[model samples]
Target chain A: MQERTVKITNRLGLHARAAARLVRQAGQFKSAVELKREDTGQTADGKSILGVLLLAAAQGSRITIRTEGPDEERAAAALLQIVEEKFGEEAPDGLF
Target chain B: MDSSNTSHSRNSKLKGLAASPGIAIGRVLRLDERGRRQFYYMEVSAQQARTEIKRLREAFAEAHARLKEIRSNLKGELGGQHEYILDAHLLMLEDKHLIAEAEREIRSRRINAEWAVRNVADRLAGAYRHIKDPYLRERSADIEDIATRLLTTLSGHTRFNMSTLDQDVVIVAETIWPSTVGELDLNHVLGFATDTGGLTSHSAIIARAVGLPAVVGLHEITKNAGTGDAIIIDGAAGEVVLRPTKPIIRTYIEKRDLDRERRVEASVRSSEPATTLDGVRITLRANVELPAEIESLALFGAEGIGLYRSEFLLLNRLPELPDEDEQYQVYRKLAEATGEHGASIRVFDLGGDKLSLDGFEEEKNPALGLRAIRLSLKAQEIFRTQVKAILRANSHGKLRIVLALISTLDELRDAKRIIEEVKRELAESGAVHDPELPLGVMIEVPAAALMADMFAREADFLSIGTNDLIQYLLAVDRANENVAHLYQPLHPAVLRTISHLVRVAEKAKAPLELCGEMAGSPIQAIALVGLGVRTLSLAPASIPLVRNAIRSIDQSRVRALLAEAVKLATTGEVEALLGRQLPRQAPQFFAALSSLG
Candidate 1:
């Protein structure tokens, strides 16, 4: 399993729609993924929208991701890529 | 009275049924009484008293069966109060004492069967008039309807024949029921005007449902519309036109055609999202009262239902609790209607402007009184039933539960606990529903918005119920017409509160949506978008206008306008800036604002 922990820098925490977007991205990979929040200690199947919703990752919180599958390395990198992209920066227009 | 003394002496042409059991001066025209007779009528021979009783029993059975069918369909569509009307109909249909007394009178007095039926109806109607319940009082119509049908059957006039009604006649009546309104062919009918029934009454519901041009609650419409006289029914403005000039007629026809064309265009654009010039996509959902209203959801291009006021299930003298299965059927039907994007059912927000429970006396100040989640918390059984119903409907499509009037963390926690408990019960029972239903709260109260971050901690999402938020924040009563003008969501303080709440939810990473009357106003709705609110729930009628506004606005320009408006000192100042800037940058937004009044 490939694992890494990163502190959330986005001002808004990981919301349901954002989490859904993350889940949508994660589903693209042939990898089993899990996201565990440092604050709530809530772990979610990175592939499930409901699981991701339960994570409720807030700003300044640390989230650990574990990937295990054929494209584990790419999955972890892409998942990290979204976090680095700041959840599609500036609310992606009209999503209130 | 002499012919000249008669009220409708001027227009002697209109004709319609006596709907409200009173003499009304109305223009003569083909009127529909089909729906009134559909639920009643005795077909058995009057010679055999036993067979007549048997036929009455069968009629009662049919009424009971029909009530069950319409009850389930109309429960969530109209308010639960409507079903009581059906209940009264069923009670009168199976009135053993009334039937027995009428049977005795028929044998003893040797009265005609039709007169016997009419006599029973009159006594029952008189009894209904004595009843205190406004709902039961309306049931007097059901009695008259059934009696009319039975009398018609005996006379062999099975239908309320309108063969004498001529074309080009504007019919006027004291009141109209759905059945009577349904009989008039719109193709030949000029217009309809009535003195009774409120906006959501059966008459109005049918008028809007059938797309007829009707002006209701006009006190003397029937007296004014003279026969063979040029008359116009201003369905749009709720006005009546009499002896209108050729120019005026031409103008009305032009306006009517334009309105029809606009409605057609709106229906066409209903399925599309509100996307901006700069490619920003906004989810525009609809706030609906009935499932029938959902027909326009697709026509308005609603992303989904934002606020499904579930309190319609709790109103009236509901003898038993609304079961989980019953609630599930309603929610499932709504969810299915919205299709894949689904609906968000705001759990019953009862009290204040809503029906008061029989036991709970009126509060001194209902605005601050028990309402929404607060009332639900006090009445745990009612709350639990609603939670279970919503949970059971989750599997049909995307479903979310939104708790209203949440002002504190403890309330949120308690609500969350109740929802969790219901989920557990469903699990234990092996109820077939989506276990992971997303739960949220409407941030309507100022306290809720002020402490939105705390709510975001436990809740799955947040939708701003700005209608109450404005009323509560401004200390203004929305229903009171005096300070209704003061209820402005565009006020800097209100905007700041929304901004703060959105920022807090963003900080917590909780998805947020704004579903309010303000979200439909182009000026206020665009401002919310600039303040970082992306999802807007609006009335279906405003969808195309709002969608058109969003499409015309450039995000960068809107962003700049927001930055300027926020630094402003007052609501007036912000309005001034928007007035100057919006017209220049977004002409469509300015156009929508102009059309507001």
Candidate 2:
């Protein structure tokens, strides 16, 4: 199992497109992926768009991703990379 | 449905209308979805549970297949953002929790897949109801859409069968959606003759783009015709002949060939100025709602947007109506799209059978109740935000913001006062706006039409909304089927009202245009022209047809017809005069729209 605590850094928060990007990248791996928001304590299936939407992960909100399976490390790393990259939008001003 | 079976008009003709003009004769394909819903809930046994679960699995596969087909079809056709939205829906179909819940419903409750899918979808959507963020909650509609597909598929819906088309077909439905119109086999579709939609309906726009002969706003068309029945559609004439005899088919085929040539001629001549034979130029502006229609405006030779209905901005934006910034973004895009001609943007005319704004409760009689400027005045804050947005957007390009549904003199004054106050506040806040920008009133209700001089005196311009004016004058709701026949624009009262308003506008020297479905109709437009209405605003699809009607018409002939008709005793007599005399006077204008060989 691999775990990483990453804050949502996108300017528009984890909106429709941003959530879609996270879900799509997460679905590429074989690992069981889940995202838990720190404030709400609501866990969402990282590979599920609806689940990710339910997280209501706004900008500056911290979330932890836990992945376990054959592609655990890659899955965790890819999700963190997507969040850090701000889903290809400019970094939310204070995030860096 | 039964009445449609009995009432086949003379020559087997069914008069609907041509929203998008062309000609076609093909096998009728009845694509009706309304009567396919399940009503009864049957009890399921423990042994039957396994089969129910299989049915649920089948539904899942079908949903995914349908989504995959739609996604693949729309792949290159949509923007990256729209494509992402579809991908998110695709991901949702594979969501373990959603599927698992459906499985749980079947196993434990022993309900049918359709009911179980709907039940699960309702529960999921209910979760979204309390959320403060409108955007997040609006995503709930996506879930409902998927669930509808699941339920329909489980109920053995055969609506999505465009994958194989061996023969050319004409689609007949109550209403065909614009988005789904692309999914239909466009290459083989001879034309679509639907039972609903006006010239400006979303489906009509798609029909024009795809070059299909589309006749919308027919009555009980789906109930009248069946699959494999021969259909002859005169799209320009808005005529349909269902189950025609062999002789009739031969005649229609000959007519269809003639229509094809005429359509080509019309397309080439669409760019010419709409002027009468005596050299009176008519300003034909397009009534547009969506920004997508902006491109079509230039193609169809629209002078400018006569009515840019801003209510579309109020659709599905939650927690509140769209703020000033959001509205400014869309209005700015509209400004750029309009180029030199600019647009007449109506303020958000909410609260009338429209989606509730900021959780406004649904009214019993939405149309007559507090709506348009009435609602805007009460909801001053939202109205001010919208006013400021429209004013701010004028800096990008010229735009005239019009207030809707102004019945009395006071309502017009109240609106003007608020607009001026907003302008002053913007100036104080150091935001730029066109203080000299034109603001107009939509002369819809009878009171405004009667007091046309008063409204003309107060506002810079006026656009006659004959759709609402006729409906209000006749005390008939046009949408209500029971009263629809009574909603006549050719009524003696309606003509008198129009003539009175025209006379008033002329005396005041107030520049006004009739922007309504009535003006879009060649028959009604000729009458309006007779009443001295030079500037006519209509749907983009109707511009060429109306232009053709106007160009060949000598102003004196139509004036004579109007003079004779106005003195007629009844609506029927007036209509009789219109039906008889106008065709004789302007033979070429009627001939332009005719497909009859």
| Clashes found in each candidate (C-alpha, N, C closer than 3 A) | 24, 0
Q: Candidate 1 residues B8-42, lDDT tens each?
A: 33212222211111011123331222323322111
Model 1 TM-score on a 0 to 1 scale = 0.56
What's the TM-score, to 2 decimals, of chain B in model 2?
0.70
Q: Candidate 2 on B62-89: residue-level lDDT in tens?
A: 7888888988888778955478777777
Query: What docking class should model 2 receive?
Result: acceptable
Whole-model Cα lDDT of every candidate shown, in order: 0.66, 0.77
Model 2 misplacement above 4 A: A1-96, B1-20, B24-172, B175-233, B236-257, B314-323, B353-358
What is the Cα-based lDDT of residue B237 in candidate 2?
Answer: 82
> Which pairs clash (backbone N, Cα, C closer than 3 Å) in model 2?
none
Fnat, one value per model = 0.00, 0.59
Q: Write down the RMSD of all candidates, one decimal each.
A: 31.9, 16.3
